[model samples]
Target: MSFATPLYLCGPLREPRQMLADQQYSGHTSIHDDSMAEKLGFRAGPIEGPTHFSLFVPLLAEIWGQAWFERGCFSSHFQNMVVEGELVRAFVERPAPGTTRVRAWAEKADGTPVLEASASLGPDDGATLLDERMAKLRAPEKLVILSGLYVGMLGAEDEKVRMDAEQHMGDLYPFSLAQKLEGITENSPWYSDAASTPWGRAVIPLEMVSVLAEYTSKQAAFPVKQPVIGLFADQEIRMIDGPLFVGEDYLIRREIVALSESKRTESYWVRSRIYDASGETLKAEMLLNHATLKHSYADYEAEASA
Candidate 1:
């Protein structure tokens, strides 16, 4: 198991204009938008973290091909990096046979490394990648509970429509990869078309996942303003069985599988699982935490006077 002679991969062949266009159409509500990024103090709308993450595909495919899907694990942190107009590189280092180390960094065309990440890979060995021991080792006191209170009250019981992927398929939005890479770069050879790839050519950028999760969160019986405090901590994409095509309309069914409250921290956590029309879990384990505003004596007096 060794990578071909080249041993290095660069991805997303073309610059992704469609992503920017979609951001515009969606009212520029993306986390990467200049205004939002400005609130976070960034230069222009940052390219989406997930979109940046997706750049890993070319190298993973080159090194492990289809096997990467079956036995790959990725854990990333959304650190202080903004996505502006820049050329990023995906680098891989193979120190020994049966072992491949990978790292990615976003850079200017002039070659300054902006964002950095690394991952190690080996055989599965038929062992559970996500096991109880790993969970305990990760967070020993963490509690996993199932709560249906939110779902029982808010979730839609009846199916509204059977979404057709074809109906939604058409001209890729302005900000989509299809449009972004148009005059800037060529389409990724890794992606067959929006509807044909195992992971689906970057039809929907990764930034939208948080949006979807937020929308799904609001749909819950108890809608509240809460930021994403933490994720699964350790999450792996086992298999992307079906392609989520661009313009394809598909049913999204959600269920609140778990909820918990920490008396020590006075915070609440909720988790929901989403399934596509085919009953295959397209995405799962969305976690959200509650928050409260702090009030000073003057603030309390002002509120009291009001």
Candidate 2:
């Protein structure tokens, strides 16, 4: 809770897994599938970018204690693909006294950058990495793959989501919170032992915040052309009120806040707001850039020529 910290904090090297080989969406196998990844020019199915978020939690928690979970933010832009078995580590640029924001990142063992990020504690009004990026987005001149999508589009329904220790998260995340704890990069008793937590309830892990928010995302049904491949090009997860708890019910409302394109992909940004079970209290928020690969869309060339 104090700033008498070192210049930086380094975490143990971890090998995050690619558990999405069977991930399906838009009626097709996703980029996390080995065959799909090869067709799209990646060396292999890369680990989901947010998996790296776990490596930084222990370090940040040490710096800010339990508050890091209640009102902390981790904003990141993934820089390189990390296939399974590759070693990666997290680093935080220790903040000076009274500072709330600090730089954070991850890298492969040989020093290849995996992702670059910002970590901060709230009541924060500070701009995150995605906040800056979204601000600079000039409306893409043309969007072929994401043409069906528009900014401010809302999810089809309010989703009620929660993570139970033994419940499998569904196709996109195919594992339970209990299963994740078995191999998590940094394990904490607070994740499973309510008796040991300050909140008196077992809290969900930092990285699993992504899982909790995304658990029922398909209900949102923001219409993007599908059967095409996509990946997490960027992400920001923030806790507003406090730590999200395991087995606790929450409601999520989503909206497409922005859209853009590059030569290889078209991206739609969605912001999911998590509310307490009664749908009244704001608890956490996640901003994500779901970028769809252009070439992977069967109609990209055909539709462009038309």
**All candidates' TM-scores?**
0.50, 0.96
Model 2 residue pairs with clashes? 70-242
lDDT of 2 by residue, 21-40 (tens): 88877677888889888988
Put down candidate 1 lDDT per residue, 118-237, tens digits, no spaces. 443434423232332233332213322221244333355322222122222112222323433343333354333544556554343222333333443433444322231122222222
Model 2 — TM-score against the truth? Answer: 0.96
Residue 225 lDDT (model 2): 78
Off by over 4 Å in 1: 1-31, 69-73, 93-186, 189-222, 226-306
The stretch of ten residues in a row with the least summed lDDT in candidate 2 is: 1-10
Global lDDT scores for all candidate models:
0.38, 0.89
lDDT score, residue 128, model 1? 30
Off by over 4 Å in 2: 1-6
**Residue 59, candidate 2: C-alpha displacement in angstroms:** 0.9
